[model samples]
Target: MKKLSFSLLAMLGFFAIVFVSCKDDDNGDPAPLTPTIASITPSSGPVGTSVTIAGTNFGDSPSVSFGTTSATVASGSTATSITTTVPAGLSAGDVNVTVTAGGETSAASTFEVTEGTAPDVTTVVDTVVALEDLSSLETAVVAAGLDDDLAGDGPFTIFAPNNEAFDSLIANLDVADLTAVVAALGGANALAGVLQAHVVADSLPADLIAAQDYPTLNAASTITITVEGDNVFANGAQVIGEQIIADNGVIHVIDSVINVEAPAVDPGEPNVVRVVASPDGLGAAETNWTADNTYILDGFIFVNDGQTLNIEAGTIIKGRPGQAARASALIVAAGGTINATGTAADPIIFTGEADDLNGSVPDDANALWGGVIILGNAPTNNNDVGGVKSVEGVPTEEGRGQYGGTDATENSGTFTYVSIRHGGSLIGANNEINGLTLGGVGSGTTINNVEIWSNLDDGIELFGGTVNVSNLVVSYSGDDGIDIDEGYTGNIQKAVVWHTGSTIISTDPRGMELDGGDGPNETAMPFTTPNLANITLFYDDVDGSNLTDAFVMRDNYGGSLYNSIAFNHDAPIDLERLTTLGESSYDRYTAGDIVISGNILFNINGVTDAANFADLFEISNEGDAALETEVETALAAANMVVDPGFGTGATKFTPTADAVTDLDSDDDGTDDELPEGVQNLGYKGAVDPAATEPYFANWTKTWAVISQ
Candidate 1:
């Protein structure tokens, strides 16, 4: 019994020893020793400098920190030695070095940060490759085969998005990874354009940046930079992190990806609420046209004398198709008034019934309906019986169409921020309606920020009116952008006349057709002495289909042009010496009554050579050497035949900084200085280069959807 008890005790002791050994194996060695830093090689250095941390018990994947900022662990590190580069955003000062491993952190060590010289960077491509967060950008650069171009010696500014940006973009697109995002972005060619949109061809440092649109490598795109307080945004994406400096360029980290598609603009729905506008007599009570409904004109609608038509902003007025006296139009008779004031956010639109405002109609669609006509009791050179004349485009017997009286300051109404599209119809032979016809309109009538596009006839025709206009944009007009006749003596400032190289009507298209008066009374009084300043006339005849001149000054036109620009036209100026009574504009030019100076003309007839200046004026009397010399001398003194440095594609009409500076500093005043009461806030064109928001932008259909 004693032997058995001794054996049981031995067995129990053996089992206990086995259990202890198994437990020790499961615990697995001792917890790793706390990491330690013996010394740091070259303890002081700048950011991005290679740093070696020599210490004890540093595990394979130990993390490192300089003060509170984290440093990226470089490759080829050992258990006892760790390599890292000094992190960015660190100030020049002393920072504590720390090593953390196996859930243990080492005591802090001192590291002195000193400002160092900029790194000797290679190409932007190389710089991108060196950044871990920019791996996605590097991948795209390689995939797009733009690596070679970017690697070359270049002054490139790259707006790079980090991996997290790409991740966010991928998630937004409902895609899995970068590859999927690329595929979803319309494959390689489209992705290439999108990627190029982030890069500018020129080097732009942070200090040189401003609140403006920066042209990108993608010709059609511009990175619009908006600075709010201390934050800078590119295409609504916040620029994050420090700007990475490179040899040939800079790299700005953006938080979000730029959209690959064109900026989506909601043009509002078409045909909301339908209502028929009365053809005549709006009564003494004010007729309010609201935006929540669409007003339709079945025939020539008339706002009779002493009546008022108030159109709300964003109101849509559609005219039905007809001809002759039955044409659909809105005629504000003499002594009538229309208060059509619209904001930039909500412009009053006038179109034909067929127009859906969805860009479905062809750009050249015109003559679909008659246009808006305002007749006032203001003086005209062609006044007949009782010092009045029947307005054209209206029936001769229509007593309400008679315009002209002794009053030069008659108040017709206010028309601001209004867009007239798809109008101008042939109501009579050689008498097509204009987009906005001001027949004997007085100086008291306020017309500003008006856009007339796709009109069959002139965009805005002023017939013996003293009504001054500002901020006018006339695009794709079938006839002249602005046609002045019957001795119009008013001021037109800051106007943009763009002809897209296509003619919707057979009539000659010109930037401005200035005529003193109609035939038989061509040289009648007032002399069409309109003062125009800061006008930009552009003809985009990429297909070489247009051959019209920019300005056709004829019929004894005696006007002054100052601080204007004309580009891509066959000829800048044309003077008619019609060998007929009172039809010689050259006579007016020689008399110093017609001044065309301080203007910029570029690429006339597709050539930048100043020799083209010889062809600048197309006059009927080519043999008149004295007249030619006088005109040449006047133009050569103040005009430039060099490139105006316009932006490309969507911003094709926008001027560059140098162009604006050159024009703004122009002191050419005396002869062609703007008359008093006209603001000479000159930038030499319709759109001000230094303006944060363009006058012709956002609201105009051409700027919002058509041009894009």
Candidate 2:
């Protein structure tokens, strides 16, 4: 280095400074660093345990893998660290976890998987939050206000859907994200119902998952599990991977979200955002009323001939309150079909518009809506032109309302697990609609597990036809529990009729108002002969007015009653003798067409003289004292007058073991032969005492306060 002149030296120093500044500025964006893992939190944990990886350079959209299994990278991940959960299907041993980000792979870090008989104490919410695939589900749970419930000590079984499933749902809905999906479904309340359909209120493991229907936490909803070989599907959604067990519950990951038939719609809310009105016409096309919305029956909504009305389970149908022509109802005409089949967990509900379905309804809630009317092509003795008459509640102008034909085995579709509540609106003068009106319904139609509650008129009335019914619960009816007319010839089994014994009811609230036929056709062919068995009729006193009758057989009625019960009624049995008709109900009883035996009548009319079966009717035994003595003799032989030892309140018909044994002893095959459709249960009164779960336990409402 030679010492130069001052000017030259200053220029050289300036060039050196310029070169140094250039080098400093040219250190462009640090060499694209490769992610490196320093340490892993809690060196050991079981599958589904949250493990944090202290690392460097974990860019966006990083993927983590534990050994051969892929781990789910949880939220709150950064360049300096990565949080992940131990994935399922991995062997219990030490494994290496690695992260790949920015097209750069990270070195492996040691992690021990300690799978034990029991997993760590984590709630369902915690487990859902820990898994990345369940991110959408977690958001939904929170939005639906189910997070807290899942976190509580529920021991629930959650069928969780993956992210791809949610994405697919969003794509199918043509929406953007979960929020958009929620909005598309109606609102948070609707979304909640859909989400709740995936949650069961029990800890059901995969091994225990069989092909059956399971009730969900959603009110009036259920998920059907179908086992196809080794794979199990819930509502057509396949259950993937092993079940993740949590402290509070078990989680079975599904490939898709379980599709709810209908999400709950708040029809009672003012200015409801969604209200599906009836179609514009007398004849409705084949349409579906999904559970995802609330339907409004502005007037008599008819499923005309050849049309179909498919109602999904858990659907809420609200009828607009009106009378006469404006009365709202669902009428299934002849040749029309109504597929309203609901499971025990999810019943099709028909109520007024004011009902919120929050159990806020009182026991006396009646006449808030109309009822269901099903008609079919069957024989009738109405004596009208062509033997066809307009269904009582519907207007005669609507030709579709006319029922009855030559076909004796016609079908009107299935109606099961249905509830008709607060119905029976006045359709005409002295003609309020029955909760369930079967007009000439044939034997091919199925009607079972039906509940009629708080009706202004008869709970169920069958006018002609031969449609059999079972597992019926009728409560708080203002009129009769069951009414038969126009030569109805069917069978009714396992029926419970409860009169709240309230004084605010309509006159003549009988347990059974049976008739052979309508008007002058009282002696018509195929008389109203119902083979009824295992029936429990409870009529309570109203303000010390013991006026309710249990059985009022008139108009030459002919039926069979076996293994039945009639309790707390002023008049237990009354047979009318129509002198105009050659054959009366009393005459029919003598001729063996009307059989009433193997029955239990407890505390009849406070055990007064009026309680006597022959005296209650106050009818001439056809000038034959022997005929009256015959009924008394039959009552003394097989009938019982002792207390039935029924469980009080809601389980008023659930008989005790002693009562069951006593009833069974009286059930001799001689005269108590059950019909083809009815079950020949040894013990009687609508309930099998040995059944662990009663038929009326889970589905019925206001059972305890029936007469309050």
Candidate 3:
């Protein structure tokens, strides 16, 4: 009996030991991170090009997967990132992009298939070559023997006027088509001479012309400039908008058409441009010397890098697309000063630098140009991954957006009662600028009480600067209202944008795009997070297009959004392609890495479905994060409104009937305060906000931008 009992005990002990072993085995191994490929640049490119992939878990990528295609890493073992050539048979359009690493297969991103090249069709060229029976403009081109010239070799810059602009002229000038007009004047060469007069032989960008009087293709004629408003004029013609950028040449559209006339001045006067940017209030240190002629600047005008200009209140500065600076145009760098102080009675006013193109008057087409650009001493991050000598399109060694110069007190100047109007547009191929670009600006730069009207691009694009801007009122911008790129570790608050476009938008992974164009991928790129709050972004344009958004975080990182409202983005809350493009692993994060809270969102567009964008949200926001979405929805319902009061007379930023945010920063002129949980006011550099400041007056005014 004793022996039997001992046997039973031994068996029990063995069973207990087995159970403990099983438990240990279950818990020993850590849960592996499932990574995925998020995106690849060029959207679609030929197979031979070296593509950049952005994703998460790239730290664990042993290999990457594209549909059934797989490629081994030639270098950069990061799981969240990989490079591979496209296999021959892949169809056009986006394909399932995926990556495998850490013994795991990640979610896939959409990779577009390669087309031969960009669409090369134009109204002018198509008419001349194809000889389309349609389009009067095309017919006119055919009549003019310039058809062969337009198709000729050397690149040219043509100032094209639309049919309407030309039609307006037809009533005054008797001509059927361009061929008849040229023939009446003389012949093809006579027309060519006229064309040459309008054409700038070299790539004389708007910025270049803003500096001095430039002579065009015509040997004798010179276009003198008086930048009262930030307007660009070509012999008194208002150059509207449009860049028909072809490989051979480029075209800038003009309104009211073009007519060669006598120069404004026979021998342009002594060229003494009196910039009366100062206001009425002048101290003993300041002399109020009266000048016969004055060029009043609506916003802060930044000429060269190392120049300074002062301003005062009640300065009836003109906002020109030509000389007059754009609204909220700050010369924040290159050491300039804009002492613009205004009072309630006579507040500093900035008006658009547009001309009356109606035959009622003769106006320069390049009248209203763009805002100022202060070329500061800073680095730009634009490099290829393989330590290649240079990037194809971007400026080599532009360094990546950076700060920290020798003169910490490098004053970009102050803007108290300044307003810029109608600014920002394309500068080059992927090389345009924004409304108020703080190019490599430092923190010491003073920016306050600034307003921007109708800008072609983002109202303000921070290019790796350290300038804190507050009380910003952006009206209708073609793209994002405010964009921080290249480590723009600045503070921006008390901003309100009510437009059919993006609010605080981000592109490429960096709400702050990395200085270097390419990093190991999204995770490897260094970026700075800014601070924001007390804002309202009213985005109506949906369809995943960038016309509107409270914010769109692309390939970038960092920042906290508190007490803001985002409404009717038209599509999903996030436009970030819901997958990491590189590799997946524990070390690197996927592309859609963001922290969103305390904001409201409204969906005017239909709700998402099971197998589509809704599915992506399901995968990304897994684990039932309904509360966050609920908050977003609530905020949008409360704050979002249609018709941002852009009526004929009373348009843009016209305060709605019941908007509390409009009064948010009104009383506290210099310093306003946020509620308790609304701590950090702006993009603080790893610091918390102590208090808030009042928003600038008229936060909801429609400033003119570069549309027409």
Winning model by lDDT:
1
Clashes of 1: 0
Computed on alpha carbons, the lDDT of every model, listed in order, comes to: 0.69, 0.68, 0.41
| Candidate 3 lDDT, 103-148, residue by residue in tens | 7777777766653121111112111222122233334444543444
Q: What is the lDDT of residue 171 in candidate 2?
A: 20
Rank list by lDDT: 1, 2, 3
Error of 1 at 342 (Å): 0.5
Candidate 2: regions farther than 4 A off: 1-284, 608-626, 657-659, 663-672, 703-708
- TM-score, predicted candidate 1 vs. hidden true structure: 0.59
Better of 1 and 2 by lDDT: 1
Pairs clashing in candidate 2? 262-291, 262-292, 263-291, 263-292, 500-707
lDDT tens digits, residue span 163-260, model 2: 21121122213233444444554554533323432333333333322211222233444445554443344445443333321111112232222333
Cα shift from native, residue 228, model 3 (Å): 33
Q: Score candidate 2 by TM-score against the native.
A: 0.59
Q: What TM-score fits each model?
A: 0.59, 0.59, 0.47
C-alpha lDDT of candidate 2 relative to the true structure: 0.68
